[model samples]
Target chain A: MEESATQPPTAATPSATAAKLAMRHVDFHYGPFRALKDISLDIHDRAITAIIGPSGCGKSTLLRTFNRMNELIPRTRVTGDVLLDGTGIYGPDVDVAVLRKRIGMVFQRPNPFPASIYDNVAIGPRRHGRKEPDVQEIVERSLCRAALWDEVKDGLKGPALALSAGQQQLLCIARALAVEPEAILMDEPCSSLDPAATLEVEELMLELAQEYAIVIVTHNMQQAARVSSMSACMMMDPDRAGVLAEYDATSLIFTNPKDKRTEDYISGRIG
Target chain B: MRMSPRLSQNLARAVIWASAVLVIGLLLFILAFILAKGLPTLSWDFLTQNPSDMGRGGGILSTIASTLFVTLVAVVVATPFGVGTAFYLTEYTREGRMTRFIRFGAESLAAIPSIVYGLFGFIFFVITLKMGWSVLSGGLTLAVMILPTIIRTSEEAIRTVPKMYRDVGFSLGATKWQTIATTVVPSALPGIVTGIILAIGRCVAETAAVILTAGSALQLPTSLFSPARTMAVHFYIMAREGISMERAYGTAALLILLILVINVAVNLLVNRFVAKGR
Candidate 1:
């Protein structure tokens, strides 16, 4: 049920340029059980693409495929092609570590390491063999970019776990940004935050989208509407597999979805 | 009916209190008895001088020195092997036939009695390897005996680390080994060190295996090849052979004090690591 009309350029869409990352007929499975069906989508750079769906619809799974993070699980299998900048990321020669570095991820709950704020941000660069001397500069730039430097600047030596939940999430964002990734994937980054924290993260997402391609999986439709420029709506099929139903500019998808299921889900009539 | 339930609850509380008091009372009684009988024999000469006429007089200086050497060798040899095995079992491999097999082996090793371990060490290290009942032999034997404890406790500690830490590490493009070294091991340090402390306790208190593999020579061992005797074995020989019950009590008291000191030292180290982790 792919919508072809939005595939072409429209005035309302944000820059119908080439996609930075593309998923072509991808399927994912956990052992014998299929989790995501054949799904194809293109994520444009310098824009926030929100993947909104009901629980168990594989929104997070699809997001993880970009970095091949799902392969960490035992007995997990992936089929089809996922390309980053027109290069097949699933190719035999592709280094998984390098791919993940290029596409950073922010988890649902804020998971800063049990370390100093400076150490948490520096850990990525350190692990990737970044020079020690440049780490101070990188940490400052990343924290500054995440909008957390002002609050945490004086306390970089303090433990990251001591921060409030909202601040922790921002610290996580800063941690991800320290790697200097071209794209950032967030899996419900603000679900555990208070309303104020949620607003802070949403605002941060908007600002971050100016430089990095951001793909977010959120259950909150209002959040999808508030932060994203493009949206992909997915639903679970009869076989308990997630399938993408509609993809279009945020305004069009919310106002006049081509698929009835997407409309039903957005209107709160169905899960 | 309500009165009956209340009465039963009160009875349960009384029983619990009595049990707690009973345990504490027994421990205190033992400590008091040991201190009263042993304190009189504890003097500077009693500690610093070599035992005269097979531990009937003089101090346990050689015994103390040997105990330290044997324990040092055991801990140095076992820590790396035990922690490495635990890391492999928990981090590198998933639960399967191989993991189950290794876990079963560890459990079996833990269940074997100390006497059986003593016999095995005597036969293998003393007879087969011809190590000649030296500190090296005793230390190696104790190392084998404590390996299971370290592996089990360390693996449990590793497992207790939140899986999200690994996820975050991997998401940042860290390799498996790097993630484990930086995040998993550091987070699990306090628990791992606790396991090592337990192993140390076992090493200190152990007598049978050490007596078999390392002959109870009263002189200070000058090297790995030199024979040694621990304080526990010295106490055993003195008390069992009717050589000197007074000096035996002194040795027992000193052993208890040594264990207390070691426990306190290890706990402080663990606390520092935990604070740093936070």
Candidate 2:
């Protein structure tokens, strides 16, 4: 274990500096096929944790497990524990709706509802039963936090689908932010965007890291290094199931990975 | 004749054009023939006055009234049940034995002949249920007959709604029913309305079933229990018995005009409401 290499980034340390979420021996199966083998990691508060791997390595699957979104798929089952703030999210008593509200997610594609931009951002607050007047404020604050208020403020009544692909993605982020979640999970949010749009989203992810625990799954190693503090490398095992290979500070994971597979992956010796 | 590429191409174009012309020419000929014979009989009194001597003379006001009443009731009764069933099939349940059974049942109902539907309605609504031959009975029978049409079309419409919208709704913490109601159903409204319009068309043109269930009474229906007569049944009775050829042609022309008006109205409605659904 490269424990010494897990150095904190040179930034204002989070107020709590404790793990916001933790997974313990978690295994996920889609019907008869195992998609993710026993994996465990601690995601710290107020830090951007990036999970980098090639396609079909279960990074998105693992990210979805945090909010229990994986349970939506038919015939899928999860074993072991995924804890948020020390309480297991998969506990029988835990409300899935409340769990998702605490941990929002951004999908790879920009999926804005066919509604006005204001309604798109306001839907989260409204769905959580916020008052009509309070919803407006929440929408503005969320969009401002997402660095989208300047462009969209005047045209809030316009349809969300009319926005450019990159703006639509930012609108999706603002929608997630409207719920005021403790953590945000992104599944290769910039994978569909152009290079300039990718940079803009990366900058926003970094800005959002100051206030929320952010976890991102990306094929772009440069993006993982640019936006995240801690990073985990995942690889498909012999059985074609994803397994976590290493976890450490982003700098060390890029510079001096302890696992041979991780070194091979980062050095472009293997995919 | 020896087959050649150019000859085959010309032959294909000629066959297509000939079929198209045949269909359009038949439609136009029927329209012109009906108008030429029936227009002389049409008058203000013909539209507004009640039939005299069992439709031998005077107007078909009561039959018009009955046709409108039965069609309206059938549509009103069928829309909710049909749309609800569609939602259940598409949103609540997975495609399995039960859903397949329901779909198969709907398809069979759609394929059943109209006269067979009349017998079933007569036996079921008029006799077993003891509703008597009234507008309510006719409407209920037509509702059953059209239910399959509405459900199938509505299911198709609901299916066209993108799955991504549902994910966005669910991920926003909306409940399942809420997600379906707010996201899925609204997007599918145009398709659902189309289903209702088709049901209306079926109800308007129906004859044997309406006659059996609603009882061809030549008077305006005063209540759901009141017996009534639709134009199609009146036309069938008139033309079959050779009682009044002029009256039958006038009734046919009116029915044709009514259908054209309905199609135009529906087109306007679709443009106003559904064109902007996206």
Candidate 3:
């Protein structure tokens, strides 16, 4: 582990007015057990932020916190705040459904709805009552953004599940992008893919980073190294409960991190 | 050292599978035998014409008509309440002693024999509330009898949908009911339909409850308030009285055939629905 420079530059850019999401001292608990403690992070307007952690270290949990996905579980409670732009999302007046339209997500496993390829991407806009953006144009645009259009162009009528494993993952990414979300949260979006597929998805993520703020949680140290500009490493404590040990630039976390656990993790000495 | 343990494990599995198949096969065989023996006596007129106590094995048109009415009404009456109760229990309520109690009560109701249900239906419809013996009373009793089956199966189907799918819908800002309506219901459609089919099969064959609640008039009733005889009750009464056994056998055969044809038709219709359903 190196030192403090791994911390992402906290200064505001001129385009920072569009700064997408921030989690503030956000503490999450499942019943009596704390999952994340004092978690504060800024996901800039259009940059790739990678969260690297051992399993059960709260990376996915933290990713879910952004769009309030954790609300599905009973007894799950959040103590701090999550703000999209300057507005507090957890504010009572905020409609959770409308909020999720702006904060879309791609899961670890490819989960395209049991629908046709066309319907899969069309669902969000239709459900949210977007007076149908040229649906053909939007579906193609989103698929192009996720790098899936070319592969699936001719067979849009096929069931989404009929795609190859890699194509399905990209399709899921396209599904997330179709909603025109300001930020896209991915939970190890490439973990299930092979090397070639992973590379394809990684490239897609980097290209997408140019337009949308992307937060990805990955177990692969190399994936974190390859994709994200800012990175945070979470470690599982002796209690087997997880906590964020360090947050920094990807280069710094891998080449020169501040914590020993981060060092052990990146070097493969320990998980 | 490990040889016997491995062999014993395999033996245990074989016994388990064999017993299951044997029991299920035994039931299937009995059903097949009864159906086969009754088939020769079956005819179109036998199903379309009314049975007469005066004649032998003549017709069961009234029985078929009344049975259809009672079962259709019962299903229509019970489905909404059944689905609502299931959704309430599985989606809204937390897993606790109270939910567990309700679930247990439902399971216990499912365990009750048809005879007990008939007794309840008989007293309530005929004696107590005085709805009298009619297709309406029979339908009411069968509706109550079928509730637990529909609720339990629908609940199981709903609960079996992947939690990830639920989370996806919820994260997208869908209300609890919306998520269920759009995603969960579609996914669980096959299982729910399977349960309904099974329940409908039971309802068609059920004689005790229908006999108690629906007075066997042998004539096709014009309204739900009029007394009528279901096919099973007609067979029961005819066979017990030792009158035209061939006609009773034919009536049984015709009813079974009709049910089979109806199921195949319904399954085809349901299967045509696109992904997320059967």
Q: Which candidate is the best by DockQ?
A: 1
- Maximum-TM-score candidate: 1
Error of 3 at B73 (Å): 1.1
Tell me the deviation in Å of residue A216 in model 2.
1.5
**What lDDT tens digits, residue by residue, belong to model 3 across residues B223-251?**
97888788888888888988777777777
Tens digits of per-residue lDDT for model 2, A139-171 = 999999988999999989888889999999999
Error of 3 at B96 (Å): 1.0
Ranking by DockQ: 1, 2, 3
Cα-lDDT of candidate 1: 0.90
Model 2 chain A: weakest 10-residue lDDT segment is A3-12
Per-residue C-alpha lDDT of model 1 across residues A157-195, encoded as one tens digit per residue: 999999999999999999999988999999999999999
Q: How accurate locally, in lDDT, is each candidate? A: 0.90, 0.88, 0.81
Give the clashing residue pairs of candidate 1, or none: none
For lDDT, candidate 1 versus 2, the one ahead is: 1
Q: Name the TM-score of chain A in model 2.
A: 0.96
Please identify which of the two predictions, 1 or 2, would achieve the higher TM-score against the true structure.
Answer: 1
List DockQ for all candidates: 0.76, 0.48, 0.41
User: lDDT (0-100) at residue B105 of candidate 1?
Assistant: 98
Displacement of residue B251 (Cα, Å) in model 1 is 1.0
